[model samples]
Target: MCSVPLPRRALAGLALAAAAPRLTRAAAAATSLRSTEWEMRTPAGIRHRIQLGWPDALPPAGGYPAMLLLDGQTTYPMAQAVAQPPSGQEPPRDLEAALLVGLTYPEDAFDSGLGVDSRTRDYTLPGPSAPPGAGGVEAFLDFIENHLLPELASRFPLNPDRLALFGHSYGGLCALHAFFTRPALFGTTIAASPSIWWQQGVLLKEEQRFVAALPPGTSRRHLLITVGAREQRSEAELAAMEPRRRERAQSSNMVGRAAAMAERLAGLGAGAPQLEFVSFAGEDHGSVISPAMRRALRFALGR
Candidate 1:
């Protein structure tokens, strides 16, 4: 069961200046719509919060499509940036009508800096190298499936068939995990800059299992995989970068691995999931989030 619901408030009014730096503009322009919050206890007894916003207009069909944003503290603010209308221009039709849900920890606000520590436990598969108390993906998913979705369904007119998920970094790894192991949970997925290097490529093992278990015929699915262009650099380019960037670019072969996975997944006969891979030029792992988030919203919410 969940705790009491809080009063709706304007996102612009929140003292989130320290919370989501990327959303400052959105926060300033977001005074038009009221956002709400709810607290729920996960099956594992961890308390988390869900922040929600509704569009000013509903689609002609009524039921709205929703995207669950992992790293909600960060992503939710960015969602505001994308969803809010700019000066003198009407908000884009599709962007204004979609539901935005942010899944975050109980005590966390957009300004919290503790997400890194919290997500290390919430986002990954257990491995020998995993930190103590880490590896709660299964339990977390269960909370979403059993508790969160039902709650959302009860309050909102959701398009049951068009659910989507977005995750980045470790959270991206989590979204990929759901894509492979629980394909029915989400019809579309956006995994940006996934930490495919985690757990010694544990998701590859899941990929093998997913293909082995796929039922005959094309399972209708859409997945977008994105990485920063700098991830795959010529030695000359790497030499020109700062030492830290050169190290990151050399260490994790993100573009190559993501492309390889797309190739292998596409080979699962004609019934496989439709996949799109994109590389954002002039971006790196950390800097890629804003562009990737915009694209993810467009893919998931745009017509």
Candidate 2:
């Protein structure tokens, strides 16, 4: 049998900063929704926490569309709000019901920084000459596909064809890797501010491979890549920063790289994922999650 829903207080661990009052209210509102938590271990003996929330309404014939989030500790609550609006709030007319699932570690919180080590190990894919503590992404993907999905299916009705994957930063890098390596895993992938510069922009090559390998009759998919307008830094912001920080920011070029990726992928014609690139105005890395996730939900649900 599926586990019982955890009490509202159990979500205290997900608390965020004062700048995120919107998310704070959303988190509080989430307490009244139908939600549950599962503590599971991967085959590699690594423990993981899975947070799930579904609408109060019953499923449609095929079941609710499911979205799996990478940084559950921070992203899950916002997703819960997007998937199911708080009591008395009218949901977007075009928005359909969905199941929001967050993949995270135990004892994590949005502000804790405790989960960074685990995230580094799980969300990065590096080469043989790469730094230590990298390249666990393949094993992580195996766990998600071979172990986690089956367990999730046993507990709820998920529409097999409508599943999506979402991640930000390093998690976003991992999501792109998952798509290039296993295109059929999720129908939609929303990568917010992906660390495209990781391992010297290796994912650019991965993207080439994905497009090259696509068969003439490959199945349709959707990929949304979003970055904060301020992520690349304005001239004034760069000048104010220390030399090293400014240099790194200039080299990273997050906005340019993400936009370029979207443009290249868009040329994949009818068979590949339909690509959408969004740059949220005036938002930075830390603040873009909420808006990007809101857009992700609409994109995933075909709104």
Tell how far residue 165 is off in model 2, in angstroms. 0.6
Per-residue lDDT over 141-170 for candidate 2, one digit per residue giving the tens place of the 0 to 100 score? 889888877666655556677789999999
* TM-score, cand. 1 vs. native: 0.79
| TM-score, every prediction | 0.79, 0.83
lDDT of 2: 0.77
Task: Candidate 1: list runs displaced more than 4 Å.
Answer: 1-31, 59-62, 84-89, 94-96, 107-116, 215-218, 232-251
lDDT of each: 0.74, 0.77
Q: What is the lDDT of residue 195 in candidate 2?
A: 93
